[model samples]
Target chain A: MAEEECLTELELAIQVLVFNFYKYVPRRSLVRNKISKSSLRKMLQTEFPHMLTDTGNRKAADKLIQNLDANHDGRISFDEYWTLIGGITSPIANLIRQQEQQNSD
Target chain B: MAEEECLTELELAIQVLVFNFYKYVPRRSLVRNKISKSSLRKMLQTEFPHMLTDTGNRKAADKLIQNLDANHDGRISFDEYWTLIGGITSPIANLIRQQEQQNSD
Candidate 1:
């Protein structure tokens, strides 16, 4: 609720990840607080267009949703969503480190 | 790197999370890319001071680190580190949602 400038970049980043989950969760659902597969696809296509373009298509996105939906409930819960993001970011982080090392060397 | 102004808040946040892990990982070791317990504690205290002050003390931080060291190797890999951050954020996100719902109602 405070001004955005007061928060550290890390703190703000965590907020964005959290807020993105809420932003995609469907309204008026019996499930209440989960993201439907369609919503998950839309979110990837919109919020992560550059990173997830390979999975941006409906079929690829469906596969991604399936992988993340550990419960096989056909929906993406916050935990699943977090796991998905972690999965995506881990390799990128490794690549960045590798590049930095190469540059320094 | 490109200018920060070009990135979405979400994109920047992902970078922060990724960069934080690299920031704490130890260098010049056989285990070249892992975070030792001391590094993890220092990171939590410095980077998450507001949210993790309860674990700021060495003992509590040790306990937290033990729980996160899923492999029980006494150090944190990037995966373990991501899990720790996810664990910390989940409850906070729930609380925020509850508060928002109450306010809206």
Candidate 2:
């Protein structure tokens, strides 16, 4: 059986979210386990195409990086990256649920 | 076109994660937008089958709730829920990447 066949929905979802982080960090930078601002901007554009359409823009992406680069290291660590994802997902989650309710009504 | 078709991989993954939280919260408690300890325990056992096998046990799941109930509300808010998901995913992410490297070698 395929790996996904054995996984639950949430398990697979977590895997997708986690693996997406690695897609941006280069192999050489695996030791640091962080993505640069440019890589993050690219990730926002490609991976988060719909959810973060505004931040997918170059200037807005830069602003996001500045706000989320908690340690001022000029790079985004896994925790910081998770924080960014959570921050973005929170409001969108509310909106999505509201739309669902409206659709069902 | 279907809604899922329009979403990027990351967007769908986020939706799965976010909506899972609501599955545990009853409609009556919708205003609070939080889930109780028992609900969280059920969520962990059902949704996070692979990622949190140990916590699938009732005792371990309760321990997890205690730790993550940041406001001591005996309930888990969306932020707390996200934190728990992130905390669990972070270490598993490292392990998964390492196993991938080994498999590719």
Candidate 3:
């Protein structure tokens, strides 16, 4: 492939990664083995109450759920969960999201 | 397919998203048109210095660069760049990462 083509392909590869990160992960309804908020909260409340209080873990979880629950159905599907909290909360992650959005348009 | 298989597949899908987020983005060599530190700093200094100070943007950028520069080669390959700030800094995104690493091992 030409140099430009390689770059384009890499760009595409990057996009695939980004789309998966932004679109797929956030939207996932659940991860079977992964810990859930209620479980984590319970664990934190007892085992690491300091962490919960210091990090504002409860509030953070709320924010995470709000961001992921795109439809506001009171519960997040796994995909919506990932998008909001999956690859989010960082500038570069947001960059991937912003780029994918731009590309789709 | 059995219900178990579907759940496993979804778990795998989630892993792929996480592995890609953690393994790829923070490790990126570069994004062609994305803003750079110096440029961002300059922009912030001029146009949005207030925001820079307000959110500790400069510090956040510093933290971002450090996290992404995995190889410490002085400049980020976009891949390395993405991983650090790409899909990190969130509990859910990090969960993807933690799972993928666990699965791989």
Output the number of the TM-score-best candidate.
2
Per-residue lDDT tens digits for candidate 2, residues A1-105, read: 125777898888888888899888887767678899878878887887666663233444456577976557888888888988887777766765576566656
Per model, the share of native interface contacts recovered reads 0.39, 0.59, 0.00
TM-score of chain B of each: 0.76, 0.79, 0.27
Candidate number with greatest DockQ? 2
**Which runs in model 2 stand beyond 4 Å of their true positions?**
A1-3, A54-64, A100-105, B54-63, B103-105
How well does candidate 2 score on lDDT at residue B22? 80
lDDT of 1 by residue, B29-78 (tens): 41366788778877876776555542234454456577776566877777
- lDDT pick, better of 1 and 2: 2
Candidate 1 per-residue lDDT over residues A9-96, each given as its tens digit: 6767888899989888755552366788778777776776554443234454456567766567877778788877777766666766
Q: Model 3, stretches more than 4 Å misplaced?
A: A1-105, B1-36, B55-60, B69-105
Looking at candidate 3, what is the lDDT of residue B94?
42
Separate DockQ for every predicted complex: 0.41, 0.51, 0.03
- Where is the poorest 10-residue window by lDDT in model 3 chain A? A1-10
DockQ of 2: 0.51
lDDT head-to-head 2 vs 3, winner: 2
Interface RMSD of 2: 3.8
TM-score of 3: 0.23
RMSD of each: 4.0, 3.6, 18.2
